[model samples]
Target chain A: MNEYTFPIVFGVFIGVVTRLYLLKTDYRQYPTYLHGKIIHIALGFIAAGLGTIAVPAIMEKEFAAITFLALAASQFRDVRNMERNTLNELDQYELVPRGKPYIEGIAIVFEGRNYLVIFASFVSTLAYLVWNIWAGVIASIIGLLVARKFMSGSRLKDIVDIEYVEPHFEGAGLYVDNIYIMNIGLPARQKEILRYGMGFILKPKNFNARSTIANLGQRQAILHDISTALGVYRDSGTPALVPLAKRDLDDGRVGIFILPQEKDIEKAKTIIGNVPTLENAIRMPTKSEANKKGRKLR
Target chain B: MTHEKLILAVITTNSNKIAGGAPIFTCDTREEMESVATNLEAILDGIAHSLSDELLIIVKH
Candidate 1:
């Protein structure tokens, strides 16, 4: 019945729509089940309600209500924990586990997207209350653009050059390029590995990229992503048929060895190229003070 | 008390080379050693790594 009622409704609607837009289940296949989608949608609705009420609360001089935003922050943090716990539990049985870093990265994204929904709601509500419905629509559009910008991080192809290399063995040792992967004792197992395995070498583009790709977590993420995209040719009690990534000590190149069911090199390369560079795994060594000084000296 | 990486068993053609803590199965021929190693690998769920032609150790990771 109040003037703020329509604005609040509009804000919440925009926020939920924004959340729906962002909650896409791509090749990652996360939140793919109906129950998972329902859980996220419920959380998104709560975030929208919190965001929408803040505008009127501010206008009514109920500044105390603003403190609820702090409550929302903590609430979203729990969403991150929930995601982490669920993913960690499921990771145990995976053919190729997503690793800690990839799980953490996914959890962080779920929390961050909630905040983006809040921002979209707040902006649109403020616009609707102050100006008009058209202005609120425009504001929500701008909000969505900002959210899209924040959603995507750098991909593997941005920082590395990927080249396919057929895995070869020297005696018992299996190698991808010059990188030593592992040793296979059994001739039959070695033959199986050679038949099913595919290898790729990732060369870092710069000094910063060198350290990033060298991270064990980042390397594991690459392996997990590739395994998930293309089916893994591994089973329980078959440890010999596992995928591995080894780094070259001399150069900052990484060698990837995978046992995928599908032997499509082009498809696998595209999947690797699209793998998101984990935010936690990114190391900006060149930006460091000591490194900057050394660069100046040279 | 718990070992993350431990040698589960040893399959070798040469008995003189290894005198160790883990269970050892000495075979007469290279083919016999390989078969034993493969069986132990399946039973113990560990990887069989050959140190030499005569020695193969199954280690759990």
Candidate 2:
């Protein structure tokens, strides 16, 4: 019917579709409930609506309408906080808890996705206003693809070599491919560890990858994900049962040990490969002059 | 503290260092600490201790 109405509705629809596509749980099955999905969809719709209306508002010379974007920004920030809190609460009951860094990363992604949806809608609407409905539809499709690409962060497998190793003990201390995991005191617990424990060695591709895996939070997140995917061995008040990740001091290799209910190495490797490299954990060795000097000498 | 009741003796290299809010006893050598722990082990009934490598955390429950 109306020129503005068609573009606005079409833009909003594309934006919502993009958001839903990004929300699909591939590895980390979180926010899978109907209520969680509904809330996200509703938020995405609002974001798309706001972005779609901005084109018409600007065309009509209503500058004050731009302020609503700032409002949306704050709303999105609150959504991030809500997500962080919910994940934190859920983490307490987990056998292996997703560390603070991972939780923060996930929350930030959720907030950023909303902004992407808004951008998609805004671009498509603007294109429609300039040309026609066909151009708007084409632009919206491109925007969706771009948003999808931007949302995907590099996984652990991209930077490191993950291989399953056997868990062994040297006296009281547990060793996984020369990396000293921890000490297992009781023989009974040691038996269970040998029987059920899955060991993995992550060999970093470069110095930067080395530093990233070395981060305590990143290692904890890996352990959390692996344990979450393959059920963790439930042992109350037993510190020995706790999953551990130890690094090889000589090389930048990391060893992870987890006693899961199911001893499936493939599933464990897949989970490790899917672990999102935490934003804070990424350490660039090239930034430091000492590292540069040392590399030249080597 | 609950750890105080659980920990029989924390024979660390550094006496001043406190662990888990439990009292720390300084021992000059590993051999000396092992002897002391052995003596304590005999005296204390049914109290099994864990000797950790990192800090030699001798935890008993």
lDDT, each prediction: 0.93, 0.82
Regions more than 4 Å wrong, model 1: A295-298
lDDT by residue for model 1 (A1-59), tens: 88999999999999999899999988888997799999999999999989999999999
What candidate 2 gets wrong by more than 4 Å, as runs, is A288-298, B1-49, B52-61
Best-performing candidate as measured by lDDT: 1
| Residue A190 of model 1, lDDT score | 97
Candidate 2 overall lDDT versus native? 0.82
Worst 10 residues of 1 chain A by lDDT: A289-298
- lDDT string for model 2 (A212-255, tens) is 99999999999988887788885545545778899998888999
Cα displacement (angstroms), candidate 1, residue A63, comes to 0.7
lDDT, candidate 1, equals 0.93
How close is chain B to the truth by TM-score, in each candidate? 0.95, 0.55
Output the worst ten-in-a-row residue range by lDDT, candidate 2 chain A. Answer: A289-298
